[model samples]
Target chain A: MVESLSLPKDLVLGSAILTVTGNSDLYIENYKGILLYEDCCILLQTKTCQVQIEGCNLSIDYYNNEDMRISGCIRQIVWK
Target chain B: MNRIIIWLKGYVKVRLSGFSPERFMNLCGNRSIHVWGVENHGRFYILYMSRKSFLQLRPVIRKTKTKVAIIEKYGLPFFMHRYRKRKLFFAGILVFLMILLVMSLYIWDIRISGNYSKTSDMILKLLSDNNYKYGMRKSKVDCEAIEKLIRAEYNDVTWASARIDGTCLIVELKENEILRQEETVEKPSDLIAEREGEVVAIVTRAGSPKVRKGDMVSANQILVSGAVPVLDDFKTLVGMQYVKADADIYLKTRLPYEYSLPFLHTEKEYTGKKRYDGSISLFSKNLKFHIFDNPFPEFDRVEDTKQIRLSEYFTLPVTVTLRTTSEYRTVKKKYTKEEAAALCKENLKKFLDDLEEKGVQIIENDVKIGIVGENCLAKGMVDVILLMEKRQDTEMVTVTVPEDNRETEE
Candidate 1:
């Protein structure tokens, strides 16, 4: 039914998959870019919105063309 | 797991001291070059990324006008680069790998299972006699031949199988339980005395008693007769009926025991001086460095050896042996008469225990210890009661009765 609307899935149906486990591991799939990187906070760009991750000792464990993993003590996540 | 691949591909710790070092990272990411482990270092920033991505960062470094310098290089590629000029290092690694590859093709261990009364060593010896020992090449070992050889060599083994499992040779055997059935058929036999003894008791189950109680019997004497003589009405013997003899005969016997214990003992005492010898064994060949005599006079040698093993079941035929010979001096020690007597008593107890295990009931033991010269002699006679039986099989004879004799009996 959503395909009948002729809207791109990544833009209209949330193509980005974000998994946060136990406030320690954050896995993001289909991410666009890293807007900001810091020890206490990280801002990532996804398909539909910008993701702001606030944490302590935040570090990007790995990053590739479309996927990224951030690991730290994550306290909150804000999507803009 | 992916990180290990990245590490093997090599990585570099680069310090960017110029303005906006983050731009350098962004530019690297834009060019499809993966970068991770970003850290701030004073006015500079340190980024650890793969070597491939670092090589591709030259254009981005010029664009950002950042000063880039490699602080450290890590991973396998860089490690190899350091040893590139040393030819011996690579040669050693190649030789080691070659040896490992060659050793893995041979059997390093042999394991046997499914044995009840047969020992593992005995089975292993049987295998070794047929070119199936450890360190034999797996390609040369014939599992079927080994199985057939084991079955033919041991009558107890009914079924056998030999196979190679990884670097170990596994052998399994099933023993024949029905091999003892041929001796169970009853035949005409007589129970005879196996040893000289006085008759203690007689319990005849299927035979006539040949000797009564307290009768002195010699070896090979018939204790029970299997023949039953048939008689006529006039007390005339007509024929004989023979059957298998079955009886338990208990006898009283005497066994002599003699043991001697020395009073003066010469023992070796360590003098705290030692000599060492070392050797290398490769493929059953020993390369020894002659530093001292192999066997030192008045000295004991302790040997320690280590073999090269790749896994639990895979071992190479290379061993290093270290032998340490410690010097000693002869010391004369004197044992008290009581101590010698106690030692003799301990030995006699063990002998008595052995006799009891063989179903001999001890009736009386008279042992005496005496000091003869520098030695203590224990002389005695043990009286034991035991059951002795020896069977001789005979064919049953058929006898025909005449019609006149049958009519006379009627």
Candidate 2:
């Protein structure tokens, strides 16, 4: 019914969102928690699955309860 | 802006050592602790959090079994704490700002514009006489009142306006271009000869003619009379009427000119030796301090002074003067005959040009230059046709006339 009404899936289903800006920065929204932090990789648990981000010199620019912004030379992002 | 706010609130860079640093961050996120700029060094994790959040991190650190230590403290709280011992420097900055604020409350500069017939010095003198001058409190100055005062004091000023803009008092003025209208409505007077000369031309604008062309008149002789004799039907003098006398009377006169120049004169010549020095002066307080030394026997000191000002209108009392002293020696110079004659002719031409500039027509020049002994003398008379303005009060007369003969024609 929501799909027939053309409602946005991210807002209706409450799924985690990953926004990439160019090749330098990434913004993650509605994430559950930070799972692991390292210089080359960062893992996060979202509502549906675990999200992993692999990068060089990866650092969190800012983070609050609902969202986090990461900035570095990003290599890849995977969801499992 | 958010970063500035965080810096203002103060923050600390914390280093977490032990297991599960990620859990520590997750616990901090759940507890509503704001953290940012997180980096990892394999053995420990480093992150930044607000000073208040760091105080509430005991439970999160204990839960994750991570030992945390503040590696670096940042922001305003730490800055103020570090400079807590140098209280005088901070106090000096506050006092300087207070002085600037106080100074802005009073006027420092006054500027007058758009005046041609009346000089700016005249208007400035009037303003100072009426207690409106530099250093006066700005609130006490009423712009409308100043406008009214300026218009009332100056008869030629047609429009006047005064305003205060950022410690500067500006006065704008417009003057009447018809400046000679007062002569037509002036008191009854007679036009007299200002110099002993033969009358060349006369144009009567208001008065009755007392002298004609080619009439030789002495100084103080009446050239035109303000009184007019009224005639009756029989062409007999009945009474006299008075009006202001105005006329253009040109006089042909001889102006005696004599100039003497010494053939041998002492002139100072520069020796190319110069000394540069400076001084600081407080003109408002009449205090001057100079640092200079001149070893030359004879020198000319040229000093240039400049006032300290933040802008055109925000001038201060401090002045800096740079003094330049150039050494010189006097030498005796002898003039040749041709040089003396040429110099004499140039001076005579300059004199004639000056007379022409003053509206005096140069009719003829009969100057002769002769070098006598050690001096060059130029003596001659210049014929000039000059219009003179001189007046005397007309005498009031009493006359008896018949009632029927009292017909007035103006």
Candidate 3:
């Protein structure tokens, strides 16, 4: 039911596959998996939540409640 | 409202909430709101708001819409007040200057023209005596009175007038032209017989004689001579002689007399008196009153005459005197023959005495007397002649006969 959800045109979600399991190993596309694993965080990658950051730099931290930081010259933020 | 009114006065627009204070704050979540306040009274206030806010809160503020006037700085009332304040001082000064100018234009000096013998000082003295003088207003000087005074004092003046020229009083005088004297001498003069009487006396100062005394000479006969011979002494020369002669002759004459007496007597006296006032006009329109009438019943008659003499400036004339002659009737006595005779003799003697006093030498006389009707009238005629000696000294001129020249001519 969540996969069939629709949002308005001002919001958008990215297409990336990810599985959520106990102690799963996931390799992020823009960042090295070791950097995420060293942070003692779970790598739960999903195509729905995966976002391709353009003209921006991305960071993920497991200890800060799945907080992802975006930096660089960002033009806009969209949620769909 | 006061703020809005002030803003309007300064060319500004104001906006404010349009509702009760409490309701407006409650509607706005108890927040403070900025409003344009206008003091309508000591206790009440008016608010002005933008169009949008007014429309949104129309139902609330519509009941509070109190129309007010806003005056601009350059409006009629502002300019009118300023102009009134500025003109007050200038208007007062203008009025004061006008009054001063008029006062300065009054008569300052009296000027006289057309006067040769009568001086300006004389005219001024006359004018001053009659209430006209320097620094007097033009309206104050009585022109007719002055003219009358000038005419009365100056007889040679034919006319006089006065006027105001600028700040000076101009007086005009007209002097009368003097009349020429007439000559009464004639040429080739002769002493004619003034009366048809005998040559009682004759005296010739010049010319030759044509008659002698004691000879029968008629009227107009040349008794004394006017023609004379122009001659030199001790020579046949021409000379002039003035002759005189006198003669005594008799004459017969008649006389008559008549006298009338009033049968009744009548008398009259004046019972009424009249008064007169005089005035003169100068320059055709100026009028002046000079005399006031005083009444008297004792006067027999009243006469007044006015003479108008016209000239360039003044009109002058003599006041012709009008007089009244009173007459009355009374009784007179008649004269008898003896009285009339005596009167006639006395008159004749007086006449002869008068002639003797006038250098007439009466040499002889023949007289007669007569009576007529109830009166004794004297008819006396006399040939009383006299002599006037022509004793003029003659100057003799001698001419020497040259003996050698006569012998040479022979």
- Judging by DockQ against the true structure, name the best candidate: 2
Question: TM-score ranking from best to worst?
Answer: 1, 2, 3
lDDT of 3 by residue, B289-393 (tens): 434332342334434545342333222322333434233233345655566567667877876788678656565554555655544544544444433332223
Best by the lDDT measure: 2
lDDT of each: 0.83, 0.87, 0.44
* True-structure RMSD, every candidate: 6.9, 9.4, 44.0
TM-score of each: 0.64, 0.55, 0.26
Deviation of model 1 at A65, angstroms: 4.4
Per-residue alpha-carbon lDDT of candidate 2 for residues B145-236, written as tens digits (9 for 90 to 100): 88999899888888999998877899999887766466346789999988899999999998789999999999999999999888777887
lDDT of 1: 0.83
Tell me how far the alpha carbon of residue B61 in candidate 1 is from the true structure, in angstroms, after superposition: 4.2
- Number of residue pairs clashing in candidate 2, backbone atoms closer than 3 angstroms, sequence gap of 3 or more or interchain: 0
Q: TM-score of the B chain in model 3?
A: 0.29
Off by over 4 Å in 2: A1-80, B1-102, B113-133, B139-160, B172-185, B273-283, B293-303, B322-327, B395-410
Task: Give the Cα-based TM-score of candidate 1 against the true structure.
Answer: 0.64
Model 3 reaches what TM-score against the true structure? 0.26
By TM-score, the best candidate is 1
Query: Which 10-residue window in model 1 chain B sums to the lowest lDDT?
Result: B177-186
